[model samples]
Target: MAAIPKSTGMQGGAMAEEAADELTLLAERHLVQPWPMSGSIGAEARGRIEGGEGIYVTDAAGRRLIDGPAGMWCVNAGHRRRELAEVMAAQAMELSYNSPWYTTNAPAALLSGRLAGHAPDGLDHVFYTTGGSSAVETALRFMQFANNVKGRGEKKLIVSRQGAYHGSTYLSASLNGRPRDQDWMDGAGEQVVKLTCPNPFRRPEGVAAVAFCDYLVAEFKDVIETVGAERIGAFVAEPVMASGGVIVPPDGYLRRIRELCRQNDILFIADEVVTAFGRLGHVFASQEVFGLDPDMITFAKGVTSGYFPLGGVMIAGRLLEELRRSNHSEAMFAHGLTYSSHPVGCAVALKNLDLLEDGLLEHARSISGHFQSSLKALEELPLVGEVRGMGLMACVECVADRVSNNPLTLDLEVGKRIDNHCQELGLLVRPLINMCVMSPPLTISTSQIDDMAAILRRGIELTMDDLVREGLWRG
Candidate 1:
């Protein structure tokens, strides 16, 4: 990796400041940012990231900050890799566009074969999409199509879990179980059933982790029994819930769920959008890390290291063969995106895969212990209730008190406070309600990890002081 560029006092001085001001004004006037509140819907001006390289990004103010969230948990191979850029440009020059509807491209075909080789046994087919949401939509649609052709059209109900973040598309978003996700938005709630989040930390009071796992499995079994397995089509879950604060389920929880899905004949979809592509030190984590043989696996994000929008579903060959052998074999699934199998995206992904295969995956694995333990030490702080995570991802959950382990109220915005402090000290954090998530680039060194943790420790200490001075927190 290259040495991260140091922060120089705002480049171009007055002119740069004026340009930034102009850009912010322009955005406020015309840009509609995502996940905005009604008050700030179209007028919100977010921090502008000017550029990035290695494990750091330069903000518009010319301050170099550690890319802590790794650009929304993508950018697995780090930023501004010349090789990735060159491959994308070369592929575009060779063959810019090819319609998947009527034609195929070399990059797409070759990449499919390569991805299939990385996927679990029997999952030999791929259906490309623009991103994670569309990939999940494609998987659900395929399940519905498969059941309809087999005369099981009534089996359309989807099962998901609390604290899971699948996607933003309608059907996919409906599967999201976070409380704030559906606060103002409408979804197909009637078609989806959600189970308890398999988080041991928040499990019912007095329940042990081992028993919590059993309770989770038992709850699913009861749902299957009551809803009737015949009415359910798919059970979708993230191996490690990402946006829902890096909720890693109890041991054997996923395998048990897979067994239940198998017994009930429900399609098991592993939404590996965040856990795949070297995030968990593997190309895919469903079977490799969690010991699951899911019927379908949806992946995005790190697929192209966020260099290009690319995501897909890995389908089991047996499922496709079963569809082929059915009487309605000629039926079309009738689903696909215009950018499906995009040559440019595939080319970028191929190069990204090369980087991961070379040594990035090993690097991630080698440093994950340091990455996790460094964050885990933050639990010593009074405001921290828990610091839980696995692999390169982790969450620093803040609470009102340690004994109660109760989350701080929304007004505190503790996570945001920590994030603001961390940013000022040269690190970026993904703030959830009262939690801060950190998943730095895979190339982050042990020393960088030390710097990140040190800055975060100081940030939390500062936040604690602020809260105490405001009379909001005793500690």
Candidate 2:
């Protein structure tokens, strides 16, 4: 790879000014932004990433920053992999678009077969979609369709958790329990029931960890009874609640949930959009990390390492058997996206998987302890309330007081403040209120992890300084 220029925009000197202004104008005038519900070309538009390689992204101005959030928790194999690029180009030239409805493409078949080997024991089937939200959408719809075909249309409710973000689609968005995700938007809320997130750090202050787990399990039981297990179709969860501040549940939590799902005949859907495909040092973290056999696993983001948008739901073979045995055999599930089985996406994902299986997964596993320990050291800083994560993913939660875990006001945008400082220090982090979510590419090294931690520490320290200066904090 050629040496990344320091400032590609200014390389054109005075002549580049016109093009940069044109881009800014177009973006400000036309391109719509997501999530923040803000104007297209405001400060909310982080920056234009011109190129990336090995966990570092160069902005249009050519300032490189460590991609701390791994491009929205994708990009497991890092950026600009020549193998992925070649495969994408080759596949696009060979077979670009096929109406996934009536015909299946070659790359799609090969990728599905390859993925089945990586999925949990019985999850051998794949239903493709454009991205995480749509993968979730497909999974939820499948659950509903399976129930309806089995003559149990009443069992269409999905149980999710507080702080969980399933997707942005109406059906999956309904399962989202995040506050910011719901405001100023509509969802199929009636079809989704939410339970408390299993974040021990944020659990009731007076409750012990063991007591908290018991309370959570009891709540799940009560909800099942209240809704009647027969009325519920499935229980959806993330192995480690990714966007919900990397909330890792206490041990034995998922196994208990698995037991409940099994006994109640409810499907267990693991949303691994951020955790799967080497993010957690595994192709599937549901069974590997949580020790639960999910009936269906919805994955995206890292599947193609963010090279091309793709995602899918992996179904257990048993579910297909049940659907086949159903008396309503003629009833089709009747759901799909235009890019459902996109060939180029599958080809790129295949190459990305090759990179992971060859060495990246093991590399991630080896460096994960160093990654966690390095981030955990941040807890010594007074501004950091907790540092929790597994594998290469983690979060540094900012609090007004470390002892009480009292959150800083949303108005402070503490995470954003830290992020601003971190960016100036040559790092990029995803800020969620007062929480900084960190999931670097699996390709990051121990030395790079140290660099990331150092930058984050300085950023947090700078944020604390700002707070103390503004009389917003004392610790």
Candidate 3:
């Protein structure tokens, strides 16, 4: 409830140095740099968030703005849910931490049971981790171990879609399809195979709906054939590509991929970090959106609404059997973190789920139709080359020429200007290359969504005018 500060960092803002001193010091010292991957910390490139509530974050300058990106598409239930905070505080007081190796807590048990009820069938067993990246790492490691235990030791290589973002950790980053993210790692390319991302908006001009699905299927088949089916461990992917510019796979895309994985005896790991916990209408996006039958589902972000860091992989019944059998031998999965399934985090996650199911999930689902319709309306805008996304997540691709759908020459500046204008108008959004994305918290009301869309439309209009003034667009 205190006065919030201006959001600095990636999104720029004007704030006095003295008020931001604490954030600067923290970033300079303990914050293990992320995103940029250079591990470079710019003093001016930081935002001191004093606190947050509902659909807005308050900065050190006591400014509150709508959170359009749901805090990087994680906080589905919004921020500062009092019940979750209370549950976490109580858990911290009673049992701050516990090792899952020998001691299991009520919070983890209850949370797992609740998750089982919501996630797709067969994805019932839970393996807790500290965050989404770890959840991804766990899925890969589990796949490898499970394969070996099942007498398929050669299944070691994992396949992921191009433009997919798994996480930024060692294995997770390796699994990420981003070229720049993998280029920094010496041997990331060796472990993971990248396939084409299914972009319905930019599908090959003449390809049929089924052809688009077959394109990805054929790509997977070719990769498996090249590597040998025995050499494949798992196929990791997002139910709906989130960080990779929000690419939504066409209708049959997921069904075909699921069939391919099943036919090949390869594990299918759904990285639902951003798509889980009611972000996509259902509890898990893979189940609700794609109707997927994955061997493992990695989750994080919205589990606790960003109130605390917690993530895990939900193991299918068959995979759990393999894990159980493997545990009998000396070759144990042997994967865990100190903060894995922390009591406080698990408690917070349980409470967060309660809040989400109480009405937030339906709230998000109810508005997705309206949100997509509004985004689709922008197709008439000459600068909007493509508008794509589903459920609560969506993006608008900005272009200089509508006919060719070519990216603007000054795409970066246009993107930055759009973001700046939105901030100036009390709305926030996430920018991915030439695309402007919105993933407002599931708790956002219809009226709030209207405000978000209006501000974003204004931002886009302003950016387009700026482009014209600079002689970028033909019109």
Candidate with best lDDT = 1
Q: Against the true structure, candidate 2 has what lDDT? A: 0.88
Candidate 3: which pairs clash?
Answer: 3-62, 4-59, 4-61, 4-62, 4-63, 5-59, 5-60, 5-61, 5-62
Which is the winner by lDDT between candidate 1 and candidate 3?
Answer: 1
Off by over 4 Å in 3: 1-17, 21-32, 37-42, 204-210, 323-328, 401-409
RMSD of each: 4.3, 3.8, 4.5
lDDT of 3 at 91: 89
Error of 1 at 219 (Å): 0.3
Q: After superposition, how far is residue 174 of candidate 2 from its true place, in Å?
A: 0.7
**lDDT digits (tens) for residues 1-475 of candidate 1:** 2232233234677756666676777778778998899999999799999999999999987789999999999999999999999998999899988889999999999999999999999999999999999999999999999999999989999999999999999999999998688999999999999999988888988888779999999999999999999999999999999999899999999999999999999999999999999999999998899988899999999999999999999999999998989998579989988999999999999999999999999999999999999999999998888999989999998885545455446324788889999999999988888888899999999999999999999999999999899887789
Instruction: Give the TM-score (vs. native) of candidate 2.
Output: 0.95
Q: Which ten residues in a row have the lowest lDDT in candidate 1?
A: 1-10
- Whole-model Cα lDDT of every candidate shown, in order: 0.92, 0.88, 0.81
TM-score for all models, in order of appearance: 0.96, 0.95, 0.90
Question: Candidate 2 has which clashing residue pairs, if any?
Answer: none
Once fitted onto the true fold, the runs of candidate 1 whose alpha carbons sit more than 4 angstroms away are 1-12, 401-412
- Sort all candidates by TM-score, best to worst: 1, 2, 3
lDDT of 2 by residue, 346-407 (tens): 98988888898999999999999999999999999988889999999999988864444544
